[model samples]
Target: MTTAPSHPTDPTMNAIGQAVAEAREGDVAAARRKLLSLWSGIGVTGDPLHRCTLAHHLADLYEDPAQALAWDIRALDAAGAVTDQRVQQHHAALHIAGFFPSLHLNLADDFRRLGSFEAAAEHLNAAEESAPALPRDGYGALLRTAIRQVAEAVAQRDTAKRDTAPGRTA
Candidate 1:
């Protein structure tokens, strides 16, 4: 059996830790902004794993799910470029972010707005089917509750929108 090599502790990871701390304290926007700058300074360079991880982090910030998906694709490609077996494991473990159900739901909302009910339903079904793993703790419960509430709200809004549209059939 082959084991993945551990990532070396590095400046970039250190910066990411600091940024995450800030984000946990409700400073995500600011943390992400600083991260963007710091990341840019790293510049035109990094190992494949590093580049893939950075791309994934940036993609998480998008309010527009469609754009997020685009970034995810880039990240996936970068991850795949790594030749090391250990690196490949690292990359494979993270593939779900590109197809996360929550993100799909957001994209579904956008599709709904564009009057694409079929597409929206497809996204909604996908989101419902994808069982994204959650943390197992009080914090996880809180987050799950919040996410469910948001999903309910989105469902309600979609129903309302459909009802209000002319010639829409129940």
Candidate 2:
């Protein structure tokens, strides 16, 4: 999902952030291991915000489209259960609405990489429809641009992963 400043008071979120940071630093396996451990403890019915954030970041650690799709799906499912209050509790600037575009964009990208154009288009459309919820800032612009690029890829039936796709180190 959209990366918001971490709320240090929440250990789960803090751990998730650290794992994400590790993945970003090119140690994806370690990050994935750390996150999986956290996920095991969180369980399926754990805090929605924690599930959403963790799954979203965890998805980025996978190079395989199908694997990423699974975690992205979990992230989207958890996002559905997340409340604005919960999101704002983590970062005052965050809103549950603002999470949808990135969530859908990631799903669409994964589906596209898997050569599921129809499904990709469906989620790409959802991302575009939710675009207005994003702030008029860098993150908003990035997701909007990614949506357009994914739409084009879907039209061309291109299954090759984009260089920019989160095919993080394994």
Candidate 3:
């Protein structure tokens, strides 16, 4: 039942927000530059929260699906390392359970985009399994809808591939 922090003013959060805004504006390269600068400060073994957030945003910057998948994997790894103390200190609920859904969903999207339907299905399943950890609010609902859409798309693509393969007819 943890609520979002009343004050979301951390430097890392601010940087992430700015980068996300830049990406949303279609300036992904600029967003990548901003995130890379922050990533350097965070380093490989930096705070898990910072690493996860940075890597997740960094993934969106890449035009290459494989590169984005790599970053999403890093984000999922860092999310697993996030500590409860860090979550409390940040006044946010970033436990692995809460983080996994989005991480897996993003990974699923990346895999689907790369035409790796099996990998995409695996991650989509993981996302669905971890979804209850998310806050039961508008954001969570939106995420759930997104997950479903991605799952449906993957299913359709897989079926289409199967039907079009040799010796198969639609």
Candidate 4:
């Protein structure tokens, strides 16, 4: 999974990003505590950007695939409510279109990990469909790579299952 980029100007987001970085560096417990604290501050009815950012990072804190999928869904729902005016006011460069790819990619991966290849493929398709709206930059490349990797993994797993089925010959 790719590291979430930081928004230096937003303290809450910066803190969340820092926690995520700490988690990536092998301090997951600390990161989870920090994120939970932030989540408490930004409740369910909080601003869309905060909800989206917090949920996106919070999903990574879960060891359980199902829990992570739940958080990804929350993030996607919050992203849908984030408007361009809010982005401009907050000086956030995030576009709702850009958020979909990451949210769907994460959901796809979670579904694949849970042995749900059809759901995974559906999310992968959503990610691909939203890819073109992403800015043509390194972040976009990373999202594209993640989408491809998940798609390939899902296909390989499906093929393996087919090949091992009863009465099937190689």
Candidate 5:
């Protein structure tokens, strides 16, 4: 089931929304700064759902990826703590942790570029797990595609090496 928005009438949430609107209207720095202020006030201890909402907002609005990722991890931990549904938390964390198929695929590409085929395979496998939750035609598909592509590459490399050996047949 879909979760409810954190307090429909909270002034803080309203302010955040306004700032986001302003950011969308071309005052990105101002909007982000406003979010940062509100973000600091959001204490770590509170209703898990409320924290999740705030965390999601922070993750979406923050300009710095490191900061956003920190908030995402916090949200995931809080969600896991409050609910019996561990799978949902895992899914949310994956999204927040740059595990979306596209991100994972890009990461795999970087590993491939560095000649770390094993690491690339590991990342591709992770990307595959998150693929079911990602958009079928967009980032998610890219992740699944990347996994397959990398797996094929690994297989080809292995085959090439084997074929070149004196004892191996073509």
Candidate 6:
């Protein structure tokens, strides 16, 4: 295992959490601003876990599908570079594989909104295929349910934003 500090003890992680908390507080503009500042500091080649987490949240702050898709892609790309040891260093319970379902789901949703059903289906299927890595908890259940919801929307060729989708009320 690396020498990375635990999530709460890590300064960068704490900063990311503060920004995410700001978003959860409904001050999305503030959160986006804060996260963008952090991203500038972190850069594209920063720690993969940090990149993954930051880009994932940053994607949600954008109402535009293209912008969100770009961030989502970055999140997924970062996830690919992350390791289980690095993830466990931040949170003992976190494993790198557990991040994929949500990452792919977000990408699927982004592609769906952009009217790219084929690409959306591919990522959606990847999300489902990666579901086994998800824990049997509320968060996992939520992702599973969201995957189903996204699948339904895809089947119907609906491009409108989902009311239940995380972040960015559109």
- Which candidate tops TM-score? 2
> Each candidate: what lDDT?
0.50, 0.89, 0.74, 0.75, 0.51, 0.88
- Give one digit per residue, the lDDT tens place, for model 4 in 46-143: 88888887788778777677888788888988888989777655554655676788888888888887899999999999999988987788877877
Pick the winner on TM-score between candidates 3 and 6. 6
TM-score of each: 0.45, 0.97, 0.80, 0.81, 0.43, 0.94
Considering TM-score, which of the candidate structures 1 and 6 is the better prediction for this target? 6
List candidate 4 segments past 4 Å from native.
Answer: 1-10, 158-170
Return the clash pairs for model 1, or none.
none
List residue ranges in candidate 6 displaced over 4 A. 1-6
Tell me the tens digit of each residue's lDDT in model 6 across 1-170.
11223376678888888888888888999999999999999999999988998899889899898999999999999999998898888888778888999999999999999999999999999999999998897888999999999999999999999988778542
Model 2, span 52-132: residue lDDT tens = 999998988888889899999999999999998989999998889989999999999999989999999999989999999
Per-residue lDDT over 50-71 for candidate 1, one digit per residue giving the tens place of the 0 to 100 score: 5555555555555454655554
Q: Which ten residues in a row have the lowest lDDT in candidate 4?
A: 161-170
Candidate RMSDs in order: 9.5, 1.0, 7.6, 7.5, 12.5, 3.2
lDDT (Cα, 0-100) at 11 in candidate 4: 85
Best by lDDT: 2
What is the lDDT ranking, best to worst? 2, 6, 4, 3, 5, 1
Candidate 2 overall lDDT versus native: 0.89
Count backbone overlaps in model 5. 0
**Clash totals, every prediction:** 0, 0, 0, 0, 0, 0
Better of 1 and 5 by TM-score: 1
Query: Against the true structure, candidate 6 has what lDDT?
Result: 0.88
Model 6 clash pairs? none
lDDT-superior candidate, 5 or 6: 6
